[model samples]
Target chain A: MTADISLTPPDPKDFLDTDSLFDEEERLLRDTVRDFVRKEILPNIADWWEQGVFPVELAKTMGDMGLLGMHLEGYGCAGTSGTAYGLACLELEAGDSGIRSFVSVQGSLAMFPIWKFGSEEQKQEWLPRMAAGEVIGCFGLTEPDSGSDPASMRTHARRDGSDWIINGSKMWITNGNLAQVAIIWARTDEGINGFIVPTDTPGFEAHEIKHKASLRASVTSELSLDDVRVPDAYRLPGVSSMRGPLSCLNEARYGIAWGVVGAARACFEAALDYSLERQQFGKPIGSFQLTQRKLVEMMIAVNRGMLVAHHLGRRKDAGTLTPHQISFGKMDNTRNALEVARTARGILGGNGITLEYPVFRHMANLETVYTYEGTNEIHTLIMGQALTGIEAFS
Target chain B: MQVVVCVKQIPDPSGTYTLDPETHFLVRPDEQVLDDTDRYGVEMGLQIAQAHGGSVTLVSMGPKGSMQGIRQALAMGADRAVVVDDADLKGSDALTTAQVLAAAIQRTGFDLVITGTESTDGYSGVVPQMLAELLDVPALTYATEVEARDGKVTINRQTSAGYDVVEASLPAVVSVTAGVVEPRYPTFKGIMDAKKKEVEELTASDLGVDTSLRQRVTAVEPAPEREAGVKIEDDGEAHLKVVELLQQKKVI
Candidate 1:
């Protein structure tokens, strides 16, 4: 079973005030991305949302800053670890989920498939452009009818001489409309295979989905592929099953697990500020039991999520982690993040609904977090099956 | 070709400047920050190192209270950092402070020294030149552009007549103006790295930087506030007012 898009868990210390978890190099990347988010993303998020604009240049800019697929070693990547990716996501989502979705899809989703499974020529052709953000990539797994069950996806590619012809539609694709390249998963004669289809292909069209409030700062689109012909070389060589698509899902989902922690931290910290300085009854609302309980619950959620994410990250870097471990983090962190944001909203009273406070926005972003990758229900089943040694994706 | 960047922490200048109530000058318990313009200098040093295959050693001088800027600079990707902390050097003038940093760098043995045009608190912008003079190295000020080619550095100095691109061979002091390249941000790994980065700590006496031998700051006082200006209208009265004002000041 595939975890959702935000598959990787970001280390909470990147966004939260964890005493000191990052080494100097990691911290340098974290602060660099954070300041970039502040200077670049913060000022434009509202406008971007209002205009339904996903700044395509942002990929290039972040790529220039060593943000795209940062954990991957060499080939223009930062050669950092999972925690560095988490920190980057933390800083990214601290701005907006829409912006982070753009990165998550571009880096973990689109680029990793090629990096992990592509040929040397493919890597040479794609990694640098993807790394530099000059080329945008999108993961095409979710179809109109197959959000939870990707095995039933209708997208198909047939071997036609040296080229493979693809036909199907991908739905809910972040940066789908602006993708310079796409990792489109389609059922071939053998099984589900991955293809790197550039957006400029002969019969490819991307229509921006009108009216999205959740990931408003991102470009959520529907991809129409009609006889999209990519060379056999563009096909991810080792990919031959649902696992190929699922592996990419795992990658994206882990990032979301960490990214939402950023959203939660932003929410919790915002509430903490309002609680201390915001007053009623001649004392700070934070002095009250109700408010304190909310804050404590939020902190508890954040800490538990951090522990899971960080340890999972260390395990992943050490090559001892499994996809189920990723499921646990995505499930726990997103759920906790949603709860924390909801609780933080109540703390703000009236200001909670306004973008003036980030809680409401975080609350909305968490909605997308809950549903994507594997849904919370799907993750529970994956973990449940992993514990019992039984498959549950029936 | 290792370069050492010297940064000082000063309070935010946007707020009103005040003297210590007890000491009758300067704010005590002032928060530490990298000098606003010095970030450019640090960036310039990093660029040079990247170009020439060397490291940048970051040196910050202030009380122990100034560690945050050091960490912040490390987050911006300095190879290493050192802090020179001494109680006697807390309020030392620009020349004395540079004396201490110069001693620290001598121990570290950097090929070049980079500093901001001026610190926020000490706005003299003269430390790099003085340090260069003391170290017997060429000094370049108000560097708008810097390019390190092979073993040589060509710096564009910001002069009143636009900017002059001057080339220095090796081992020189370069002061930089702000807005050259936006300083890099601190990543999660960088924050973690900064913690493990050994901030070699030194005191004034440890560097043998004797403040007693330096020019004594016997009196430190706030500059008198400027009175609000009275505008003179365009007429004979304006000329007369200007003449009378100069006459009252015994000028002309």
Candidate 2:
């Protein structure tokens, strides 16, 4: 006896029916961001990647849409729930990881510190405009030698009469070249103090970094602060230790925990569609067992990563989320997303190497995402420390 | 002016949809999205309400899950919403749907009622007229442009030839086509605000409307697959073959 069998195409990336987990409003917020990405980012992303330039004007568009600092309250911010903000990150990263990074740097790194620790006068001066996207902002903390160990930063600030003079440099800063304000963290007599310095201040300069293989569509730059003097009032008075900057990094890392799932899902979808259409050996490549195994693995990783991100997001919204929980999610999701992207790239064969397919672009972007906002190794250590009552990094 | 817009929840047209083999009703997926055509009607209602200094209320009837579509309209700037979801309303025909909607509208009290030309799935094109008859108001169909002033409404209605300008008093029913106005995407702020917006739910008993099915579908069949056409090679006799095929079909 002979048997006949046929293979069916895979469904969308939401194999677990994840939409049921969110309320209608959360889903609507996600759909709105998804539509914006489909219309604005997806069409021009490949070209923007090829040219190695970020569209500076989209800041105004995003501001008009109330995406900047959307989770913050008052000062023209949307004051949405943290879960809604995570959904926005997921949708933004679905288009490209570079877009999500720009928003993360602006909202979490730059605006978050000011919102959380800045004095009322400083808030009145900058929060509304930053939320409006009329003024751009960047966070300067990582120096050339300080990637993970920010406590060893060489940047220093000294008191000069009524003014404070800051001198140092920051590397691998997103939105640096386009920012109008820089939140510079420097060592002071008290401790690590953060100063909100205007980028146009005398002796302040930012140069765009060239020849980047990852995150090419984003503006990454090196910031130079040479005797940049500002009034003492520009210093954030509420925070006096490295905890100030580390808190901001936690916020951005939380967003990244949700963002990488989007990148992985996009790559998996691209590979799945290509495999079903591209024929080989008198049948679709999807008919092969090896291709099916790769696709299934990619799908599971994307779905599981989203579940972790969503759980963490809800916890954050409920005000019960811990930094170590965020670290666990960030570590698992980014590593799994990078694996999914790499496996999907393999399924695409030679086509995966070209920009015509999104797998390669996302794979390259995940490398940067894997390292920034606390590296995979750093998060693993954090989890290790949480599990055991001992610190690993001496 | 108080504007009431009619919205419907339909299966995603982009996905594969089928009719129930036994009941002949649409097999709905777990998630039912708002119809694309209704978005234009909601946008038009919002624009008119904004200009005339009034509130826009959305009215819809479907399964309990249909509240998703109503919430989407509310997120797009509607003031509030009323959804009629009851098990007895299943498999309702166009006229029955109109009756339920008419009852719901009477409860809401509207100066102007707007609706899409047709639902994407049903495509009946008769609900607006039936609704106007039940509400005892003038019905303007296929409106491409709408304006309201001095308790009167003017609309440019699309027709086969071109468009015809029509005027009606306040308390009228107007059906807008898909391209009547560009719909705005709900901003993040709008989506958050919608969570606080009020959504009133009712059932068929509350509306006091009989939802007995008047039209029944006995069977459903898939559309016939189109056969591939024969390709004529570019030989010396290609023109002759084309003429012969056309002549055989009595075309010329």
Candidate 3:
């Protein structure tokens, strides 16, 4: 008897012709980010995840490619269309959610606040360098006890002569340990204010969070500020309420709505390849109806997630995107993506539990992604409030 | 020091491509990309122009959607682009392509012209020489490296034995081989700026060139498959088996 064994796996499954939806420029941007991921991230990601360390040099590489603050206008930003930015997020997250988080926190969380609300000096000082990736930044709005409810944060900023002294702690901060700057949101006498604190300051400390099973390839840290003082000019002069931080979260959540789709696609592709190559009971497992069902469900979820993301992206570019619409996208896409990842893992059998395959890693990463930047529960309530005009969140 | 780089849009080699069984011509998909080999020519042109204080202009002749390649070149820091797109240009041979490109390059007024050694799809290695003959410039093909200064150009041409150092006056044509220089990825800033860059489009009438197809593709067939070789696992007797097989083939 002759055995037919193939060394290479089958090509990835693309059930939906997604390219028809994007313009040429948007497709180019997605391809560029995808190429970068293939070259830079995919080869070393497994080891990085095993060690729980983010590659520090990727900041400069990504900065050189104009990924940091890619969607912002001026100050050395790429100023691409909103749809292009969403596509980039999708491709980056397809490599790993941690890589996408690094970009989202830089562009949407840190640089966005400075660009949207900071003083002219603040914008002039940080935006260009941040866009160039010479300086890395993180958003400090989530505290140990203030997650899901940001208005209850205990981090406070007090006025001391011409300087504002900030004392607070931010947990679950992506790129925190490696960031040179932190946009810390704290309660002030006027209301909640955002401070651009240099991490090298006298009282600023960032300790890496250890023993994390999810987002292991990313840098997550706890930031503690003890009387960190900066000039009054450092405060974002545009807004004085929690809306400042909330708006930034809205932008990040929009990226997440696209990013989780990438994660789900990665898992689905892995499962599809594994199923086709793996044989059981004298036949390839993918030929079975149950395996085909799993693949089809995953394909539909991935495509639907991307469709919602593209729709919201166009609305954002047209300036007609409402927060509630974004809430719907974030809630639906993340929940569906998490389910897809879990189902894909189930299809992979014992191999799904190992780091050698991307399915388990994405499944693990989506767990944290599901909870952060407006949890699925929080987004559902947000949509509920918008529809019923009743505050179910309280 | 004005430089012109010839570019083309081709199907991504990593993706599947099909040829029309009836026409025997390439049936391209909706997604077309800049040819990877041509990127070296664009990169070289940009670097030489930047170092010598001039602008790099891209000249291409393809279908309507071929602007994708020109835009990609522009995004890589080329100053502007000129696309000779016309319906009559369909099924044009390398000679016809060279004629159209020569006219466009003449209109653009270039001091130095660069092109890839060959298109990945055709690999004829004739267009650059044809373009040189049409433009009355010295042809420097298979250039591994090029340097221009003081109204003179030098090219390190690759050959079977080794390299050949060739020097030519200004107003010359050089076709670069792959790996002449590492092509840089277009930064997001570059992509944004490329949108505003000037793209001058011209047809055959505007370029004063004949676009009729002189050579036609009658049929296309896939390459013949190679026979499978025997695999001998290293089981201590593998070397003896290999010798026996070689002797059986009368090679030992």
Candidate 4:
């Protein structure tokens, strides 16, 4: 039976109501994902972290909820708008960067290339399976010897008739071992290109990265592809050079710009609420000047990051954004979010160090964040070069 | 079943929309989402469509801003949306708004229509019945259970006493209050699908509005001031005293 809609308009203040900026559909989707994250990911986040196991079920759950490839339109994707895509990242990362990383690897790194850069057959063969969570995808770029500088990687691919053989190793790959397909970045005769290398392919192996203190709930893997042969059709047609891998970075980094803010928000809100509720010296710690200052500072950072990401998102949607602009957002927001997480940990005192509180987990996750997706120094150099017309990285 | 759900975008309740000094009466459009009561109406429309294998077309009468409510309905799995937008329709009184909706209903050829018992802004409970009058259709107010089986609408109406179930034929209108079935939360995927759904827009002229009909808002503002309360200690004695006070005030 249909429930009577109380048209008595709710006091708009009751909901987040990001309606004007987003269409009704997008805003509602944002809220729905937000609510799901809050209910599903937040409560068990610490437990999963301390145990050194991601709620592996979380990925499948997210996929079941149609969170995977939320922005890629059609082809079994939710085909959400840019804002919805951003907000989903925000909510997911609010739980932990590791969980966010899993999604990033699966969507931007894996599914996106096949959809945007791969052949039609590749898209048809992979998209539905990826969308259904029947198959997972990961991107292989950062080599073991290379962290910030992927362009200098030694991974290479050679053509043999209708097949190409690849021999390379990728490090710091999220969802690596668990994924069915890996969009391996390798130096080909055509320069750096992408190949859809299945994890089950001959001479392909991915072992889960072990003993990681940061992003513990995330499944990080290192991949070794030795003489892994795939058909020529597996090559990404939309990409001919280094730009292919770099484009994936552009996508991941944009999500990180929004994702890290969620990290900061979780830390800041945790500190704010904890400080208010945790009593010290016969009053709430939030009543103390030092604590209040930290909270206020964190708030300023989070809010500022939100505003910056919002504009960057608008520019992206408007088709006016450039790689340099994206770098600026990623750099500024990740740095601020890392600082916020650290300070939030400080406010929590001894309790902050434990996985029981979100502060420490977020703080540790930000360490990985500060280094990934172009790195802090890389972004700075990109912006510097854009400003002065000088390539400082060289 | 061609079910039409009337929704309005109002202020976020938490915002406590303050009135604009110049225009009065919470001048800015309520931080808009689906009207709470009207959301139930939307769900009812969708439910009817789901069970009967028909289309649910969500409609709203307000400024273009009202499209948010329509989109929300669409995300709730409504098949389509119709938006009635116009400048003169701004701050429309209940009767004039009903006339506009009645005309739109005629154009759309609706089989069944559902609405909230009252709008949150003015809490005006006149719309559904007034709209029914304009359309010359049978209207049921405060419906609890609405069952459409074999060309008959069996409605259980909530009254001051309890409930009164009645049967009505096709082309009927109903208003529902709270205590209906639990409304479903908009799923993330549902919202994603809604973006692809079409939201067709209509205007006051399309609704065949009479400009002569009153559209005046001389003053609008927030509720009256609330007095400060005494700070009660979080102790057993204080708690007991609070309980006693509640009992004394007949609130227990």
Put the candidates in TM-score order, highest first. 3, 2, 1, 4
Candidate 4 regions exceeding 4 Å error are: A1-29, A51-67, A70-84, A128-134, A277-284, A318-320, A350-357, A384-394, B4-29, B35-52, B59-67, B80-252
Tens digits of lDDT, candidate 2, A272-323: 9999999999999999999999988998999899899999998999999999
> How well is each residue in A50-159 modelled by candidate 1, as lDDT tens digits?
67788887776787667788877767666678877877887788788888888888788988889888898888899988888888888899999998888999999999
lDDT of 3 by residue, B129-210 (tens): 9999999999998999899999999999999999999999989999999999988777777776777999898999998887
What is the per-residue lDDT of model 2 for residues B1-252, given as tens digits with 9 covering 90 to 100? 999999998887868888888899998765687898999999999999999899999999888573566667788899998889888988999988999999999999999999999999998899999999999999988999999778898999999999999999988999999889988777778777786998888999999998778889988878899999999998799999999999999998
Query: What TM-score does candidate 1 reach?
Result: 0.79
Quick one: ranking by DockQ, best first?
Answer: 2, 3, 4, 1
Indicate the docking level reached by candidate 3.
Answer: medium
Q: Kindly report the docking quality category of candidate 2.
A: medium
User: How many Å off is the CA of B40 in candidate 4?
Assistant: 7.8
**Tens-place lDDT digits, model 4, residues A1-394:** 9999766753311122233556555566776677667777888888888777767666666776677876787677877666677878887898889888888877887888888898888899998778767788889989999777778989999999999999989998888878888899899888888998888998999999999989988888999988999999889989878788888888889999989989998898888878989998999999999988887789888878888788888887887889998898899999999999999999889999988888899999999899888889999999999999999988
Chain A TM-score of model 3 versus the true structure?
0.96
Q: How big is the positional error of residue A311 in model 3, measured in Å on the Cα after superposition? A: 2.2
Evaluated on chain B only, what is the TM-score of candidate 3?
A: 0.91
Error of 1 at A347 (Å): 2.4
Contacts from the true interface found in each model, as a fraction, amount to 0.32, 0.80, 0.64, 0.60
In model 4, how large is the Cα lDDT of residue A134? Answer: 79
Chain A TM-score from candidate 2 = 0.97
